[model samples]
Target: MLKIVVLVSGGGTNLQAVIDGVKDGTISNTEIAGVISNNKNAYALERAKENGIPELCVSPKDYDSRELFNEKFLEAVDSFEPDLIVLAGFLVVIPAAMIEKYRNRMINIHPSLIPSFCGKGYYGLKVHEAALSRGVKVVGATVHFVDEGTDTGPIILQKAVEVEAGDTPKILQRRVMEQAEWKILPRAIDLIANGKVTVRDNRTIIAE
Candidate 1:
């Protein structure tokens, strides 16, 4: 079975999606090894505990520098010997070392379409606000491979939500997240696990 470690910084809706998928056979041949967070107060930890999965909290403030933080983070994750790492609402910028170590095995689900409303300081509600402000007819979420840049990895899957005229950030986010995140994240993971995803010149090729 493929072992997975999830990194979360907020509510674990996506994490829950993964868990439910695995349990219900939507995602097969994988086990959630553990869940880790930078914030001790993160609600995701409770979700992990509820599932009887081991959980760890490593505060970035405890480390002297980004390098140290990355080292410690890697140590915590390495303990599980995970085959893949999933970032579910994790807020920190991953260090290059970890990115290099995991490389294609790391994935993240962003709340908005990439190359649009992404990068540092563009997370959660901010992404939704940006979409509404831009008057985009469509808003959606992306599941992509994790690289050194913020949300710039090769895309694996995306699902769009039509931006309604009266849509508030919250309303738009709710609709997009329900369809995009809960659906695409698991599909991306399944694609990787089944060897149906390949990176060709920085693009994702999903086998038909």
Candidate 2:
């Protein structure tokens, strides 16, 4: 089985999608080794528990310094011996050492089509806000390999959603999540777990 550890910081809608995918065999030959959250009260933890998957909270607030938090956080994730790390809605800035260790084995679901409303300061509803401010007609989601730089990773999959009139940031966010994020994130995990994905020259090549 491909053991995966999921990281989240919120309600875990994206995390739930993975769980559903695994249960339905959409993501074959994979098991969730654990779910780790930075927020102690994150609903994602409860989701993991209800599903009988191991869950943990490693918050930076509990540590004296960022370095200490980073070290302990990495240690906690390493304990699960995960083959793949999935950042579903994880908000914490990943430590460089952890990123280096996991490299292409780690992937994240960003709220927008990268290189547009992506990179630093673009997450959650902020991405939608930017797209609306720019008056773009199409907005979407992206799944990519995690790298040292912020959201500057090899793109795995992207799905675009139409931007409707009178759409607020929150409205657009929901649409993107429903129409794109929830779908592609699990698909990307399935692709990686089934050995249908490859990273070369900072891009992903999907196998036939």
For each candidate in turn, give its C-alpha RMSD to the true structure in angstroms: 1.1, 0.7
Candidate 1: 10-residue stretch with minimal lDDT:
186-195
List lDDT for all candidates, in order: 0.90, 0.94
Off by over 4 Å in 1: none
Model 2 stretches astray by more than 4 angstroms:
none
Task: Give the per-residue lDDT of model 1 (tens digit) for 75-107.
Answer: 999999999999999998888888999988999
How many clashes show up per model? 0, 0
User: After aligning candidate 1 to the native by TM-score, how far in Å is the CA of 174 from where it should be?
Assistant: 1.2
Residues 75-186 of candidate 2 have per-residue lDDT tens digits of 9999999999999989999999999999899999998888898988888888888999999999899999999898899999999999998999999999999999989988
Predicted structure with the largest TM-score when compared to the true one:
2
Position 161, candidate 1: lDDT: 81
Clashing pairs in 2: none
